[model samples]
Target: MSKQNFVIGLTFVIGLIVGGLAIAVWPAPPLSTPAGHALSLRVPKNRQLLDIAISPDHSLLAYTAITDGRTRLFLRPLNRFEATEVTGSIGAAQPFFSPDGTSIGFFSNGFLKTTSLYSDGATPITICAVPGTPAGAAWRADGLIVFAGPGATGLREVAATGGTPVMLTTIDQDAGETSHGWPSIINDRFLLFTVGKHGYDPRLTLLDLETKDTRPLLLADGGGFVVTPSTLVFARRGELFAHHLNSKTLKATTPKNPF
Candidate 1:
């Protein structure tokens, strides 16, 4: 071969070998573990525990415990497996965490109250005066709390710093939406709740917070919890079920069979 052609051939062969070695030595991307680990939670023995809430960071668990014939709030670190009672409160329930996870908002007696995870006292934010009891609550990132209002009136919201709550949405009697309750925020702009005349007829409804418009999302509902931006878990007739949802467009897909 000519001297020039031989040199070019040798360089091309060397370049092919280097490229092969680089491909073989490069690391593959890490895979995420989709399986869950089993951890048995030790619930309170005598107290009827209800309305459990986990923190945004998944480090803390809060729930309502009916002990000594009075409802109270309890919190426990998930790593420790022990529960601590929240003091300076008179009957509390339906606990939800703030965006930062440093504080919790709950319904106490007839008012909405907020208490820090590291503090010993709770401060009332507004007089909900919910007859019978409050059904559900959700806290927003912008320091506003949406909760169930008195006597199936509708949903109400108040500043986290304490103020009079303004009505957010009310049931349309003409449409047969007799009452509204059990609210859960699907996103910053939309809320998921139940609206019906009776317990057996509760239906899942979506509310647009920005425009104050409401619509039905599911025909049956007990309580709806947002598992992800595109998924929701709801309870009905003592059974749990889930559905795929498009939060951006306020649309829900076919629900899976209840488990």
Candidate 2:
């Protein structure tokens, strides 16, 4: 099968702490080893972790860290204790894995770029220029990437290889909507994102990729992800919450509960 046709099957967990750096991975229950035990990774006193993402198969991790006054991306296998820096990933932030876990996508120097994880002397490939710092991005199985760009007011779609981006969603200024960001691809035709304004009020929203329609799912303070086909997870006030999601209708089937 083609790489673009690959589907990611692992759960995505993100941990971000401002001013300090600590990374913990808590695998879901019922594994060969006991669950809920966090595997913490620490950085040196001089370096600081900024953002992180897990590979699709959960065997590797990609994170952005400040080292030598430059923000760069690093890769760490779960079985290893140290992470190696990606050479051409200076200024990289918000790193994410490709669907097949062979490359990583990140924002650097006002552009979205990708780099191979295993190639020798591979340089970062520039996908497209973004207006401002991106809020978040997700790679879809169909070879398209959706990201929130340019003040995070709307969503934009660009090919994974490289191309000009087209607007996907328009913010409803009259409805007090200020920005739309943190996109998670549910499938080829639907997306989960967050809608926010000046204050901390954020709503989990669902967008139809085919029709360009949107629907509010719940009140969430951060990005939401479909952990499973029937479950959605998000955060509110630093606490995680889960909901029974009807993926077909893109609606929450149950009330929010602590995750």
Model 1 local distance difference test score? 0.68
- Alpha-carbon local distance difference test for all models: 0.68, 0.74
User: What TM-score number comes out for model 1?
Assistant: 0.79
Give the poorly placed runs of model 1, Cα more than 4 Å off: 1-35, 120-131, 198-200
Give the winner by lDDT: 2
RMSD (Cα, Å) of candidate 1? 19.2
Q: List per-candidate RMSD values in Å.
A: 19.2, 7.5
lDDT of 1 by residue, 1-259 (tens): 5533332233222222212212224333226522322334477788875556777776777767678898888887766778888875558877778978998888877777887776645544443455566767888878888888757488888888877788888767766666777776666778888787643468898888888787777765455766556657665554556677876686888775974
Each candidate's TM vs. the true structure? 0.79, 0.83
Local accuracy of candidate 2 as per-residue lDDT tens digits, 1-259: 3211111111123332110122364334445633342345666777777777877766777777788999988888766778898979999987878889888899999999988887775899999998566788999888888888857378888999999998888888887888998888786678888898666578988888778778888887668767567767776655666678876776686564564
- Candidate 2 residue pairs in clash (backbone atoms < 3 Å): none
